[model samples]
Target: MTSHQPPLWRRAVAELLGTGLLVSIVVGSGIAAQQLSPNDVGLQLLQNSTATVLGLTVLILMLGPVSGAHLNPVISLVDWALGRRSGTGLTLPDLGTYVVAQTVGAIGGSVLANAMFEVGTSISVKDRATTGHLLGEVVATAGLVLLIFALAATKRGVLAAPAVGAYIGAAYWFTSSTSFANPAVTVGRIFSDTFAGIAPVSVPAFVVAQLLGAAVGLGLLLILFPSAARNTGDIVLPHSAEKTSA
Candidate 1:
């Protein structure tokens, strides 16, 4: 593939489309699990979460070559913090464009779920979203973002993409929120009226928690992988930050 400086329009569109696709697969799977095994919620969550990880991993692998497929605002922020973000740090234009694309994409994905499952907001908020649950969301999302940056954004992780997928799969099990790591995914879940709906009032807490968790995860990653964490990619894309500047 060629190194790209995408037309602004195309990149923005890609961000939206990618987010939409992620939600459709994720929320769609959650609905499927519920309907297929209504009585066994534990099993349902496990199956749905597994499908989600695979879906996201596959989506990233497929779309990443085209767009870098950051897929989450927190992931982008962590990359910027780590010095791997394009333009060397997060620029307002880049951040704004990405956030808008992700938000729009989330809505698009939710709409698709609405159509496919015949789901409507008519189903009231069963998941009022407690503070503890939101706490779980923060921890789960942060770990996911940190993993993405450490493994994919950093130079060492560029070569360990498959491991990134493995770690995510496990995170879904270990984390209390079943690892709804992507902010785009979190945003899209609001559209679902099933077990995943997060009340609008509680969204601020979730977002704050996600941001904080990502920070902690990054700190842990730096401590654990000191040498690799030091990598600062002179490269923008298609090359690890660790690549020699020859």
Candidate 2:
């Protein structure tokens, strides 16, 4: 938002490209894992989570300079919501563009992943919206939001890349739904009928759960660190104009 920062268009493209690649990594690795370890579900998850962890960390480090790397809708939404009072973080207009870019990037990434794997893009038939899965989404997303903002609030934004990636990797194993905590990623996964895909029918509930989780995360942040909202602009990582140029 400063003179030295990248323009909105450039930042939006960064978000689109970063989010696309992230989903590609997710879907591609899932397909590879399925083929590599055909019978062992645990092995498949291991491969998928490992790739996701590395890929996401790289994406955040690579793109955080441009867009603050708010790759998730809830992240953007929460940023806007929390910063409204402080007049910081993403503006309403920017939030809208970010979400659109993310959603488009997510779908494109899924399709690209299917193409890379030589699999036809089709709606996923994996029904994952069970009560346990929904509950897992809530926990996973709440934890994600809490982690990101907590880092920013504590001036540990430098650790966001690895910390967020590690939390997600752990959540993949602990959460029943494998922590598809992102709404855009969830929607994108609906296009690929792969091991990492989710049923289209489940996307609505998943998105709702994620939104609710964001609220819970914000509530927790306020309770534990009442001053957290003041640093909402730093969510995810520090992408100040000066740092970005450096």
Local error of candidate 1 at residue 126 (angstroms): 3.5
Question: For residues 94-197, could you state the per-residue lDDT of candidate 1 as single tens digits?
Answer: 66787789888987887787789888743326553577666777677656655655554355444334555666668667776666666666777776777655
Flag regions of model 2 displaced more than 4 Å: 1-4, 242-246
TM-score of each: 0.81, 0.96
Question: Of the candidates shown, which would achieve the greatest TM-score relative to the real structure?
Answer: 2
Candidate 2 steric clashes: 0
Model 2 lowest lDDT segment of ten:
237-246
